[model samples]
Target: MAAKLVTRCSLLMQVLVFFLAVVPDAFALPLNRLKSLTVIEEVNRRGPYLGLITVIESEENAFFATGAFKPHKTHPFVDLSGRRFRVGKIHGEKVIYVRCGVGMVNAAAATQQILDLFDIKGIIHFGIAGNANDSLSIGDVIIPKQFAHTGIWDWVNLYSTTNLSDVVHLDIASYNVPKGEGTNLLGHIGHRNEEFYSELGKPNTAQPLFWAETSKHWLHLAANLENLNSTMNLSDVVHLDIASYNVPKGEGTNLLGHIGHRNAEFYSELGKPNTAQPLFWAETSKHWLHLAANLETSLSNGFPVIVFRGLSDLAGGQSGENAISKFGPLAALNTAKAVVQFIKTLQ
Candidate 1:
C-alpha cells in the first residue's frame, strides 16, 4: 500500500514490488549505483540548506507522493564518486533528497558525500521505524533522544532464572569511540534481574505473544551523540532471564503492559530482517542514526541532526509478518510532513 515519492520514487516503488502484493511491472536501478559515476562539476550549488534523507523508494512515500507542492526546481547532482542524487527547493526550503539504497555501507557512503560536497547546516533522516514503546500506536512518530547499534556488543547471555548478564569491550569493537572510554560494562548471565515489557503493550489472550525478554551487552548508546561515554554501573545493569529467549513464537503479544520497574529496552533494531514479525517495529533509524551521529560529530557546526521515524507496521501485528515494513504510506506521509513543519519553524 506504499506510494511513490511522486515521480522521483516511481522506479523505487517498482523496486518494492516484492514487498507489496499488487506486484506490477517496475524498473529499478541497482541500489548501489544510485549515485553518479563520477564527481559532479561544482557549478552553482548551495546548502546549510536542509538535507532530507530516506531509505528505499517506499520510504520516499512522504515528500514525493504528496501533491501539496512540487519541487520548485529539480537539480541534477551526483556524488564525487559519480553516485546520483536529487536536489530541489520546496516550500521555500532548499532540500536534497536521496533514496540512499539500504544498509550502513550505502548510507555511510552517501552521508560522506553529503558532508564532503555540500555546505549543509543540518541533516534529518526521516522515514518509518518499527514500534518499541507500548504507549505508541501505529502511525505514531518518535524523535528519539538516544539510539544504540544492536550488533556492536560482544556477548549477552540469559540464565534459567529471570536474570541477565552481558559484557562489552573496546578491543573487539568495530565502530569508533573516544579513547579511555572503552571497557564500559562487564558481567555474566544472571548477574542482574530485570523485566522487559512488550513495547506493544498488553496483547489479547487470543493473539500471539510478541514481546520477548531480550538481552543487551551495551558498549555504547548514541541516543544523544553530544554525550557519549564508556562508563556505566556494572552492578546497576539488569540481568536477562533465560525466559527471555525460551519464550515461544506465536506465544502472543504482552497485553498487561505490566512490565514492572523492569529495565527498559527502548531501541530500534533497524532495517534488515526480511521475516514476518520482523524483530523490532520496522521504523527505527538504525544505520541512519550511526551515519548522522558521525557526520554531526565530525562537523561540530551545531549542525543539528535529527531522526524522526513513524510506525509503518506493528512488530507482530501483520498477517504473519509479511507486510511489516511495506504498508507505510501513512507513516511515510506523516514523517515527510513532520520534516516540512520542523524546517518551517526553523525558518
Candidate 2:
C-alpha cells in the first residue's frame, strides 16, 4: 500500500511565492489564478529519473485510454498527487510516463504536479479527443497551433445567459509551441526540419497576441494579429466550433482545434447513444496542458509550451457500437508514437 504521506499545496505555493518575491517578472501570469496540483515528498538524488519524461494522458473515454507500455521501472508514487510514474529509456532518451486519469480537471491537476516537480525539457500531451472536423479520418493526427476549449466563453457579465451572440467569445487560449521559444531545449511541434511548425517562430504571424480582461487572459484567434480585438460573430468567427467544415490548415490535418468540455452525463444528456457525433468532445485536453508548460517555462524562463492532441472519434460522429473501442487505441497509440518521434529530436 502507498503511504498517505504527501506534501501540501500550501508549501509548494509558499516556495513559489518566495521565488516570485525575489524576482518581479519571474512568472508569466499571476500565480494565484493557477490551480494547485498536489505533489508529495521529494525524491532524493536527481539522475535519470529527473530528466524530461513523455506523458500519456489517455484515460478519458473507452477507446484512446488503453494500450500496452513497454518494459519500464515503476518509481515511488508522488502519493498526494496520486501518481506513480513509470521510468525507463525511450528511443535512447531517459524518460518517465504517467497516464493522466480521465477528464479535464484530472488531466490539469496531474500535469501541474509533473510540471512542478520534474526537470522537464518540455511536454508532449498525447491522448484522444472527439473529432468534429469531417475531413479527417479516425486515425489522423492533429498538432494544434492554438487550442479552443469549448467549456469557456466570455459573457457580457450577465446572469443566466444562453444566447450565443449576446455573450460568447472564446476565452483562454490553450497554446502549443512546437519549437522552443529561443534556445530552450524543448522540441518543435513537428520535426524541426519541417517548415510547418516553424511559422510560429515568426511573431506577427505565428506567435499569438493576447487581450487581458482583469485576471483572465484571452488569446486573440484571428490570423491577423491586429484583428484580435474584433467583435465576435458568426461572420467574424475565426473558428466554427460545432458541425463540419474544411479547417484552414487544409484537408490532411485540421490543427486548429474545437475541443469540448464534458462530464459523466455528457453523453446521455446529448442523446449520444444515437448515430450523430456529440460536438462537445472536440478537444479533450483540460486546462492543465498549458499550465504545466507555462509554469515550467516561467521557472526556466524560456522553455516553450507545446500542446499536442489527437482524435479517436468524432465526438460521436460515427454510428458503430464498437467504434470508440476500435479507434480509440489507434488514435492513442498513433498520438503516442508521434510524440515520441518529436521527442527524439529534442536533444
In candidate 1, what residue range of length 10 has the lowest lDDT sum? 228-237
Number of clashing pairs, model 2?
Answer: 7
Instruction: Give the per-residue lDDT digits (tens) of candidate 1, residues 1-347.
Output: 34445765877677676557433223234333333332223322455556667776676756676543345243455544444556666667776666666766677567656655666766777676655344544554545533333333334322222222432223223232565575334323221111222223354323222222111211112232212111211011122121222124456544433222232222333231332222231224353344333333323333456666666554433334433344466566666655555555454
TM-score of each prediction: 0.50, 0.44
Candidates in order have lDDT scores of: 0.45, 0.38
- After superposition, which runs of candidate 2 have C-alpha atoms over 4 Å from their true positions? 1-80, 154-303, 320-322
Best by TM-score: 1
Cα lDDT tens digits for candidate 2, 1-347: 22322356667788898887977665533442232222222332333332323334443221222232332444433334455655445556655466656554555565555656666544445455566645545554444433223334233222233344322333212233553343332222211110111222443333322210111111111112223212211011122333243333234543434524321110111112234332322244332233233223322323344433455554544333524465565555555544444444443
User: Model 1: runs farther than 4 Å from truth?
Assistant: 1-45, 68-76, 79-82, 155-302, 316-319, 323-326
State the TM-score for model 1: 0.50
